[model samples]
Target: MRLALVLGEVAQGLRRNLSMVVSVVLVTFISLTFVGTAILLQFQINQMKGYWYERSQVAVYLCTSFDGGPCEEQAATQSQIDAVENELSGATLAPYIEQVEFETREQAYQNVLEQWEGTAIAELASPEILPESFRVKLVDPNQAEIVIDQISGMPGVFEVKDARAFLEPIFTMINTLSLSAVGIAALMLIAAALLISTTIRLSAFSRRREISIMRLVGASNRFIETPFILEGVFAALIGSALAGVALIALTEFFVGGYLAGEITTIGFVGTSDALVVAPMLLGLGAVLAALSAAVAIRRYLKA
Candidate 1:
């Protein structure tokens, strides 16, 4: 019987402030969507980092006849190449370098041809234009600078290029985008909180006379507050459910389908990420709603 009365009061409050409840729902939905996006983006960045960084290699380019960098008058000699190979396998550098491969000028030119296939650059490329090099895969990719400092001015080397350098800009851009999404989500959540507070205050004001009577009849504070709390909870749950749906759609259609197809080399986030984030968003909504209702009721509907 008590549950029935509380539920009835909750329903009446919702009906009275239907517009405000809908506003809370929409605001929470949009805010939680951004939150999910930010979290999934961070996951995506970590995934890419693990995938690419483990395989990152440092290319120590040997001098060529046409080289413009700090190269000798001629192409690198066989003795110099052998010396570089020896240093890579020697005890001094063994801890840093996991493996090293020597690519001849012809092999380097072929790689350029394959990579730049129909381009004008490929048409203009030649074996003599490319440098022979040692491709060193590091035990730890972050230690590329150590290898670079050792090899940069070595006899046969013209340049030591860390593959990670090319990827740093991409990672920086992704981080910036994730931060922007998080910032937007925070602002929207603040708006949702304020809207929730207003809705609860209005609902309590509308039921002031009934609350007064209940107070006079020795009704417990918990009994009077439960209905208002349920009103906020119901609205927040609806909003959170909508946000979950949006997250699932984003992961499925955008991340899984579109991005996966376009960037096949890297693994993209899937619907499982949405599933993981859904409960967190729902919990956030519930907590925010409960807190807002408690504050409003404590201030306006004091027993």
Candidate 2:
């Protein structure tokens, strides 16, 4: 009987403030969608790091005739190459170095040709311009900096390059994008909270006379507040449901259909990831709405 009365009151408040309820729903939906998207993006970022870090190797480039610095415009001699190779096999670097593949200038030139076959770019490349470099595959990619530091000043070394140097910029951009989405979601959630508070205040005002009669009949504040709080929760829950649907669709169409086709090297957030994020969004929406409504109603009742 108590549940029925609260339900009726909740229904009445929703019906009376239908426009405001809809506004709250839409706002919550959009905000939570951004939240879910940010989470999925972070998950994708982690996946990319795991996938790329394993395959990434540190390239210890040897000096060519065109190189400056220690090379002084002279090509690396056989003695210099032997000195660098000695360091790789030595105790100082042996444990860190999994395997070293030496690429001669001729091999590098051929690789260029194979990459750009039938193109003028391939014809313009020459073995003289290419450096004979040692590709050091580390047992642990995290120790790349250590390897780079030790080999950087060695003879015949022009530059110690890591694949991370190329990939860090891309990761930074994606991380910035994820943070931006979180920022936008925060602002939109604030807007939704304010809308919910206003809706509760207006509902309380419209039914002030009935509330006074209920209080006179020995009604408790808890009984009066329950309906208002439930009203907000219902609206936010609907919004959360919509946000979940949008996330699933995005993962399916945008990730599975588009990104999977465009980028074959890395895996992406799938429907299961979306499913994991959906519950978080729903809980966040409900909690935010309930708190906003409770505070708004309590203040109005006191006034």
Best candidate (score: TM-score): 2
lDDT string for model 2 (1-303, tens) is 999999999999999999999999999999999999999999999999998998899998988889999888888889989999999889999999899999998999999999899999898999989999999889999999999999998877899999889999999999999999999999999999999999999999999999999999999999999999999999999999999999999999999999999988788889999999999999999999999999999999999
Tell me the lDDT of model 1 at 83.
88
lDDT string for model 1 (94-150, tens) is: 999888998988999999999999999999999988888889999999998888887
lDDT of residue 152 for candidate 1: 77
Q: Give the TM-score of candidate 1.
A: 0.93
Pairs of residues at least 3 apart in sequence or in different chains that clash in candidate 2: none
Q: After superposition, how far is residue 221 of candidate 2 from its true place, in Å?
A: 0.7
Query: TM-scores of all models?
Result: 0.93, 0.94
